[model samples]
Target: MDATSRHSKILDLLNSQERVEVEDLAARFGVSLQTIRTDLRDLSARGVLSRVHGGAVRVSSAANRAYADRRKQNATAKQTMAALLAEFIPDNCSLAINIGTSTEQAARSLENHRGLTVLSNNINIINLMMGGEAKELILVGGTVRQSDGAIIGEDAV
Candidate 1:
């Protein structure tokens, strides 16, 4: 496979396995060790993964992937879950939500509901709900997490 395809496949493996060794990647892709090393180096430089001694692990803080990558990952599945959640949540009801990509999807799914009040610490969810889906949107006050647009602290609690 080509470099782009190889990189995507490597990320997929990391999603399932959490870490990947250079030798294993080289074997799986039928590439040389040097090629696998180069790929790992490039991905690490891009801040997508962290290079270890003989392998790379997902670049994560608080066990959360990079915000952009997380947004792209499992999008359809997230949507499906959000739709199911919305089915159980009646219109004109109040909802409290936390931060994460899945919560963002839930906010999106609830956009069509009427007379909804949403309280959240997730900035992305607030923004998504601001398209007038919710009758009221309350954001918790706290320090904003630059990595994922989440507000956290005692104030948020």
Candidate 2:
């Protein structure tokens, strides 16, 4: 397969197994060891995985996936949860939305709701609710996380 498709499959394998050996990948894909090494290096560069002695492992637990990547993963489930959350919010009320992909989905689901006020620390949520039916959108300011537009730090608390 082509490089992009191969990379996707490698990511899938990593997701399921949490790690992959270079030899196994080369044998499975009918490619050379160098090819698999290169694939691992590329994926590592993209922050998708970490290259080890004989293979690669998923990135560390301390680091979150890229915002776009996190948003795409379990997207359907997030949407469903957002829809359910929207059903519970009544009109002319207020809400405190947090940062993260799920909260973004929840904000999107609230676009049609009227007479509600939204309190959020996520810049994306504020942008989404702008000019909508919500009566007011209050952005709790602090340090904005460059990775996910999350306003955090002690000031936000």
TM-scores vs. true structure, each candidate:
0.61, 0.62
Residue-level error in angstroms, candidate 2, position 86: 1.0
* Sequence-dependent TM-score of model 1: 0.61
Per-prediction RMSD in angstroms? 9.3, 8.6
Please provide, for model 2 over 44-149, each residue's C-alpha lDDT reduced to its tens digit, 9 standing for 90 to 100.
Answer: 9999899999999988643457888888888999999999999999888989999888899999998899988889999999998888674788999799999999
Model 2: runs farther than 4 Å from truth?
Answer: 1-63
Given candidate 1, what's the lDDT at residue 84?
98
Give the true-structure RMSD of model 1: 9.3
Worst window of 10 by summed lDDT in candidate 2 = 58-67
